[model samples]
Target: TSERILGGLSEQGAPVPQGTAAVISDPVKGNVSEADVSGAAGPLPKAPEPAQIEVLTNPSAGQAAATPVQNISTGIVSAVSGATSERLSSAAAEQGAQLTLEVAAVIGDPVRADVTEAQPVGPDSGNGQSPFSLAFLVNLSGLIGGAAIFFLVGGAAERLEARSLRTSRTGLWTVRLLLGLAYALLIAGAELWVAFGLLGVEHEASTAQVYLFLALATTAAASVTMLLAVAFGPAGIGISAVLNVILGLVSSGGLAPLEALPPFYQAYADWLPLRYVIDGLRSLLFYDGSLDAARLEGGWRDSLWFLGGRSEAARLEDAVWMVGAYLVGAATLGYLISLVRDLFARRERPKTGKVAKAAG
Candidate 1:
């Protein structure tokens, strides 16, 4: 009816039928005319809109566009997870393999480790294998060698006075000792790796144990350095320098046996730490342990006597004695030097007064 009224107005500027109520209905609901309805008829329910039907009919079009993206995300997550799991599995397997290899390595070195029990099968045989001797030699020499070199320098440095030499009153001692110990440990460790890892000669139970041995050896070397410094004072540094030279040249790493050097160096072989260190290293590598049977022989007896005590569990006594000796030696030298300084002071006092009185 509203449309008819609008149509009449557009066509001839005329009004709809006078006093007639206009009825409007949706096309699908069936078109009702004004003649069918009375004036008392209430407004008919509003017709359903076409725009609402169009929206409801195609609600999933946006979802359809997003389907490919959802699928791609799921696929990517699955691929990344699968790759990560595979890599973790492979890494675990590799670590297991390394552990197995290490175990196998420990099992294989019967020749170097079990020297007393393990022997060559054929007719070509050497007699009397000793395991304790081997281990004792290894453990003792590194300690003794480091100590000897440290003190020998002190004994020689009793000659040079610090004032005469154009050098620092006291140099960087802690840094020097630290460096020395570091170098010593470095040499020992590298050689041990070659001996055990490459040559398959020794079996270190763990890296921790090796570290412990290094710490002990470094400590021994440091103690000796302290003793030398105390014994000779500033001159002791010179002693350390000289001793370090000999130790570096002769007893360094696999370069043991000073006798093997030039002919002139042969006498030093017996007393030098190189031979002892080599013997001690062999003991640690080839024998049972540090306090083996072979270490009881010769100068090693003194080392044991000095280090040993009444109880088997007692700590090393030699370290105490050695340090004490270092202190006593230092005190004696200091006393002598003090007297020299006092004498010089006394001599310089009177000559000036006598010269002034004569001139007046």
Candidate 2:
């Protein structure tokens, strides 16, 4: 926008929004807020006849940015920081539905239409019969199962690795983190395999599932794994492993709905919000969550507090926030536990009594 305004001042002199900006906003066809045109003809003694704008609008950086309706600075997805972000943005822009929301919507869909783009753009994908598929239901069941196993098995290994890495150099800790991430990724891959080959679920992984799960899981798992490594001092990794699996199974709702899960599961589930992270993927895949759907569902309304109001991407934005909370919270808990332990370890020190006396 800064570039558009400044560039307008330089090239077009007093700016008419000659390109796509004027088209989508329909400033001319629609109404431009009078304020934006404050410097128009009235100020210029002989303002050149309002510069004629070309009819066809080219999609450009400037035009893609829609003016915010409220706090939301939409279209920040266009200016992604990395290549992955850029590709996701491009896919969303080109196809309103990404893998998560659009594809996931098809779980239990007998039509198999949701797996592919709808021929006529209906939920059923134009398959006259079997709009809801048994195969889809089976696959959804498999997803929940796979997700459960992914977390449990992956987490268990992570715990062992952390314990092994304790007392090692910082470099070893870094390696532990890397290996932990690998574990998370491997879980996803392994689950996909189970979904396909073992269960014969026939569900193809979507961009949304792969990316969202990997991202959220990796971020949270790394922090939690680190906490286990330092604080448990040996057993942290294994504890984290078990916790990850349980968290994945109960919280994720991959097999069962959140509301349907037993009471104890719900009790622990809230504390383990990784389920929300997982649901985010399902919501994206199955619900085909859009700006409108997001508005209706009230999903991740304010997820971009971390970024400088950049990337208001609904699914991706929500995923980041959920994972970020886990990461920060787990790390904080890790530090607190470590601090408490250090104090307790020194409790028996000869000077400890003197120090306690002095402090008291």
Which candidate should be chosen as best, given lDDT against the real structure? 2
Would you list the C-alpha lDDT of every candidate in the order shown? 0.36, 0.40
Local error of candidate 1 at residue 69 (angstroms): 84
How well is each residue in 74-176 modelled by candidate 2, as lDDT tens digits? 1111111122233434444555542444333322121211111212222222121111122222223333333343355446656876886322233333444
Q: Please, what are the lDDT tens digits per residue for candidate 1 over residues 140-226?
A: 443454455445543443334343432121232333345445655665576456545664543323444444444444444444445
Clashes of each: 7, 20
The C-alpha TM-scores of every prediction are 0.30, 0.36
Q: Name the runs in model 2 displaced over 4 angstroms.
A: 1-169, 182-209, 261-264, 289-316, 328-360
Please give the lDDT score at residue 314 for candidate 2. 48
